[model samples]
Target: MDRTPSFLQQHKQTFQRVGAVLLAILVWQVLAMAVGHQLLVPSPLSVLERLAGIWLEAGFWSTVWFTFRKIVAGFLLGLALGLGLGSLAGRFPLFEILFRPWAVMVKSVPVASFIVICLIWMSSARLSIFISFLMVLPIVYTNVLQSIRSVDRQMLEAVQIFRLPWAKRVLYLWLPQMKPYLISACSVGLGISWKAGIAAEIIGIPSGSIGQMFYDAKVYFNTTDLFTWTIIVVVVSVLFEKGFLALLKWLYGRLEKL
Candidate 1:
């Protein structure tokens, strides 16, 4: 009964992305050939070869797990605190005023400065957690506060008039308004968390971390390893972002149905 396009025809965006990636790889191959130096610019194939075997190497998964847990812990802490503080700020103008200066300071201060300062307070092994939390906190806080402040007064009045239960009020009223802002915050915050966390690890050089591998690669001038690790970071970050967003959207969808 349907007269729709073919499956491939429906996936135009996917095909375009594949084509773009292939073109980029081709360009990289050409540039590597022109350079004629593996140390300076390894070909895509070389990086791929390294990527294929990097997982088999000792401590690879443990290193990845170490960084992953730290980054995720930081992100979750930021999200929880941001939402809680943002809710308080949205409800009370005085609280917002008191917190404004601190938020501004955190937002304006450089990440390197924060990392160096934090190192004095904590060990290198735990540096990524604080760095990622600091990086993500302001973003989530700002987005959440804005979203809450922008809620329609008329909708709030209606909920009160109906005398809805607190759970229903949140699921039916607040969640819808907050969904977009929260998703946006999470998307941006997740990427920043990874980048900042990795940077901290690199600077702190915690043993058996992906960032430590990056530092080692730089110290040894292993361009192929550097590129391979870069690819791994990108792929992992993208995958996590996609999966988290999908789950968030799904949760919102299920909540809305209730």
Candidate 2:
């Protein structure tokens, strides 16, 4: 097997990334200075100042918690449903046939349409959960199904021949094979869930949400606030993605040791 990149190489790459980010910020500051108006393009420093102010506010944490809870709930629910359905579809032709049309529709439908329709049927407070679930479900389902299909037939046949219990088969064979796919799906799906959930919140104007803050910023023409809130969203989204994926990898490692 090929060896992983050395620590020195990884550190070099990290420094390069940091350098690139600094260069981009420098360019942004120069442009903002040339514009001579905060409205047009606020300097990076101004946005950072606004970020600091927002960071100190209790409402900021509340909004973060509110959105985080809803998004996580939706993501977990979608993951459970997708895994169950995908497993069934992978195992049985009948289940795959039954779910095919629905999966197709989900993958094809525009998120905006789902949000509008959901708004008519559900409360605004629940809109984020619904939208996030909808956005994540298809991706998880598809990725998991693909993973299932990719499982080694020889290994499966060996398990069958040995008459292993279903649970044993799943724990020993299925899960190990599906690790990469599940991880990939979660990484992509979590980001999608956050984006869709926030978009839904914006449209639904849910009280005390990050999306609502963005909406308020727009209403007041507070571009600095808008940029700051957007920065918060990006930071939170990236952090969540990284944290969740790391957890998943750790769990997989533990499972392998077992």
Candidate 3:
């Protein structure tokens, strides 16, 4: 007989999530009615209708795909560079010293400043990639460096005593120890990448981008379109985050089994 709790069953949490979403939409509708101005706050129904309209447009899909490609490209590049740099910084004091100021600056500087600076240096089409990379780099670097520092000294000593190969030590010990930090870094970095990338696109207004649609909506004062596009961004970002994190979790499971 299956002894699992009912709460742990499939679709239990799904139903709860759907109920919560419906409740939130109802609250939003009530609040919009109370406000009595679509400009100030669009009704949920109006936004949904706008979303449906946009969903039928070929241009909408193109813009979404363009923005998505740039965001993903930037995120991956930043993730790779961050992992490499963090490993170096973690392993060598000199490298850490050299990179510390840059990491600090990246972490502390306002994203708007980065966007403006990048706009002057490159075409609008590439701004999202650069901005997203900039936003994600320090996060991944800091988290990974911390993870490396936090590795157990006893484990290192054991590896040394066994005279294990460097690759073996790194694979079995270092990578396993850093899994939590890597996961945390990825979660934070992915969100930052999307936020900063979209912000860059908005400011730059590149053709064939979600940001351009947002800009056009603002220019025309189309509140419904604006709300609809904003919802699309949120939905896309959430879906990407969920998918990426699930993949990360699966990778960690494989690593653990190894």
Off by over 4 Å in 1: 1-8
Candidate 3 lDDT tens digits, 1-258 = 988767647678888999899999999999999999999889998998887788888777888999999998999889889999999999998999999999999989999999999899999999999999998889888888999899889988999999999899888988888888888888988888998999999999999998998899899988888888888988998899899999989987897787
The sequence of per-residue lDDT tens digits that candidate 1 reaches over residues 183-203 is 999999999999999999999
Q: Please, what is the whole-model Cα lDDT of each candidate in the order they appear?
A: 0.93, 0.90, 0.90
lDDT of 3: 0.90
Number of the top candidate by lDDT? 1
- Model 2 TM-score, 2 decimals: 0.93
Please give the distance, in angstroms, between residue 244's alpha carbon in candidate 2 and its true position after superposition. Answer: 1.0
Clashing residue pairs, backbone N/CA/C < 3 A, model 1: none
Candidate 2 residue 174 C-alpha distance from true site, Å: 0.6
Q: Judging by TM-score against the true structure, name the best candidate.
A: 1
Evaluate candidate 2 by giving its C-alpha RMSD to the native, one decimal.
3.4
Task: Tell me how far the alpha carbon of residue 158 in candidate 1 is from the true structure, in angstroms, after superposition.
Answer: 0.9
